[model samples]
Target chain A: MKNPIDNLNKVFDSRIRLGVMSVLLVNEEINFNDLKDLLQLTDGNLASHLSHLEENGFIKVRKGFIGRKTNTTYSITKAGEKAFKDHLAGLENMIKSIK
Target chain B: MRSKEESLDALQDIRKMMERSSRFISLSGWSGISAGICALLGAWFGYGVLARTGGESVSASSRTSQVGLSSMGEIQQLLLIGRLTFAAAAVSAFIFTYIRSKKNAIPMWGLTAKRLLINTMVPMIVGGLVILRMMQTGYYDLVGSCSLVFYGLALVNASKYTLNEIRYLGYAELALGLIDLWQRGYGLLFWALGFGVLHIIYGTMMWWKYERVQSK
Candidate 1:
């Protein structure tokens, strides 16, 4: 039997990272400021979490200019979605086992 | 190590953040209240114009079988007043929404806000054009009903992008429009009830539900 704990993705272990993934799952694309505002995270903290997700290839980033201002947007990848679902399943299984 | 309760709370928080990011929630109750007051005032002014012209028509027809002021002239004046009232209400609504967004530290011109405006404006623009054409062809009696119906449609269409409670207001306006259509001559009264009274009630409910608790 596989350990349910093994199914929890380390990349999404942080609450902030989990929050980011949760937001990106629902929204097609979200700009940086919106994510920052929603998560209530400092600039440095959000940037580092985004970098971690980017390095893991779980989220894609697009940087562009909007009327002379640089805009950064983030979206979840297919891999990210699958990982999130598996994590949720693991959580449910763990709870069921406990009950 | 996080406890089960902590994990569950984190999940809930994430869900809320996702919902907040995707949906526009900066709509102010003050916008509805101001619009309602404007609509009431506009209805009063409309009543004044109608009474003056109606009295003139009756007395002039009895005396000389002709109206003192041409029916066309009266209609033109009423149309102008309607336009003015609509403009005032729209401006006030915009101002209140802008103020609320600023207060909430939310961008007023975000993607969701743009989508909401576009969806709401499309039906309103089409309705305005149709009403203007009707006025040109002297179908003044149908103007009130058409405006109400179109405005209701606009609200319903835009409700997907904003608070869902607005859909109820849209339904009420649509029902009022249909009733006005059947009643024919009581357009102003129905308009007042639909726009004036309904908006105030909606505004009060929204304020009580959303704003009052926040301030407390």
Candidate 2:
């Protein structure tokens, strides 16, 4: 018998990363500040989680300047969307199995 | 291993965050309520103007007992009153929405809000221009219905970026506008029903559903 836990993506195991993916899935592109505000995460914590997702090729980052200030925006890749959906299915299945 | 409750809580949190990112959820119920009150007051003022103008024409031309159409000056005065009332309502609505957004720690200006504003304003602007033209050509009977229909379209257009419940209000407005069109000569009554009564009902429901819980 295969373990249901195997369906859950390892990258999405962290709540913060999951949160970042969830927000990215709904929006076309979100700036770093808006992400931070939505997730309610500290600057360093959000940056670290973003880098991890970027390294995994789940999201793409675009750095630009709005006025004199640097603005970084993030968007989800197709891979990210598929992975998040799978992970969500896994979660739903897990809940279903419990009931 | 995380417990089921923890997982469920995380799921709920994710859902909320996603919704927040895509939707302008900071619209306050008070904005709708104040707008309703303003519409009612405007309707009352408009009724008074019409009555006074009609009474004046009756008194001036005793031979023709029929109420004559208002003069250009009287019409201009009524239009000015309508514009002032609309401006007051808009400002009050903005103030209430700003306060609610601040209290909720949501940015009042953002991508979702910008989209909502653009979508809502496009229909309203078109409707305003059309109404103005209709007034110029003396098709005043259709003015109230056109305003309601266009305003309904605006709300429906903008509803995609805000709470889904707003769509119902849009539909209600559209229905009222259509009914008003069918039943002419009661434009002001339908305007009161659409803007005043409908807004108060929607605002009360929204407050009960969203804000009341938060207050507790």
Candidate 3:
């Protein structure tokens, strides 16, 4: 048997990343403002975590305009979804083993 | 290995986040209550029109008087009342839902809401078209029952995106519709029961379950 924690993605270590991924998993995409509102995070903090996910290719960014204002939306990539799901599976396994 | 408790907490957190993001739970129980009131009011008005048309037993005898509404004027009048009632209920529900979402700090038109609307609307739209065709073909007796059935399906379809209580309401409507199918002539009565009475009951239950507990 293998240790489940070892199989966890290191990028998911932060709670914000976990939250972002979780939100994206259920939604097709979320605009920056809406995501910020959902997470209740300050602009700088959300930006940093979002950039981190983007850097790791765990999420994709789409920049478009809603009339005059530019809107930036985020959605989980296939890799991101798989990684999050795997992380979840690992968590589930840990529970099963302990029980 | 980490303790089971720690893993459990993480799993709970994940479940919460996913559910919140995916489901539109901001719908106020008041939405149901108001919609039910509107439906009941509509039924009363419809009954009035039926009475004025010299069709005393709008609930029974008159339905068998002929295949459908006796005259185009009567159909138009009943339809107008029905449409008004539906519009009133919808608007009221939307207003209540919007206010509740605002209070809860949830986005009103998010993807979850969009999905909910789309899922519910598809069935409702199909049902609407089918019912219209029935009206044209003089199958008025079946209209009320079918509406109940279709409305039930729409709610059941959208239940995943909203409160679980609605699913039960949907089920009740579906059951009533099925029973009304064989009963015939009783379409008006069943429609009132399914749309009017059932809504009030469902709305009250929802309010008691969610709003009462939360507010108090």
Tens digits of per-residue lDDT, candidate 3, B36-60, equal 8888888888788778877757553
TM-score of chain B of each: 0.88, 0.89, 0.89
Instruction: Please provide, for model 2 over B141-184, each residue's C-alpha lDDT reduced to its tens digit, 9 standing for 90 to 100.
Output: 67888899999999998899898899999999999998878774
Model 2 off-target regions past 4 Å?
A: A64-71, B55-70
lDDT, each prediction = 0.80, 0.84, 0.83
lDDT of 1 by residue, B1-216 (tens): 545665566567777766666667788788888889999998888778767866432111122223345655666666677778888888898898888788777777776786788899999999999988976665666778888999999989988888889999999999998887776457778888888899889888888887877667
Clashing pairs in 3: none
* Model 2 local distance difference test score: 0.84
Candidate closer to the true structure by lDDT (higher is better), 1 or 3 = 3
Put down candidate 3 lDDT per residue, A1-99, tens digits, no spaces: 687677678788677888899889988889898788777799999999999999999999999999999999999999999999998887788788776
Worst lDDT window (10 residues) for model 1 chain B?
Answer: B56-65
Residue pairs with backbone atoms closer than 3 Å in model 1 (clashes): none
DockQ of each: 0.44, 0.61, 0.51
Chain A superposition TM-score per model: 0.96, 0.95, 0.92
Give the candidates in order of DockQ, highest first. Answer: 2, 3, 1
lDDT tens digits, residues A1-84, model 1?
776677778787788998999889988898898788777789999999999999988899999989999999999999888998
The full ranking of all candidates by lDDT, starting with the best, is 2, 3, 1
- Mark the regions of model 3 whose C-alpha exceeds 4 Å error after superposition: A1-10, A28-34, A40-45, A60-99, B1-13, B60-70
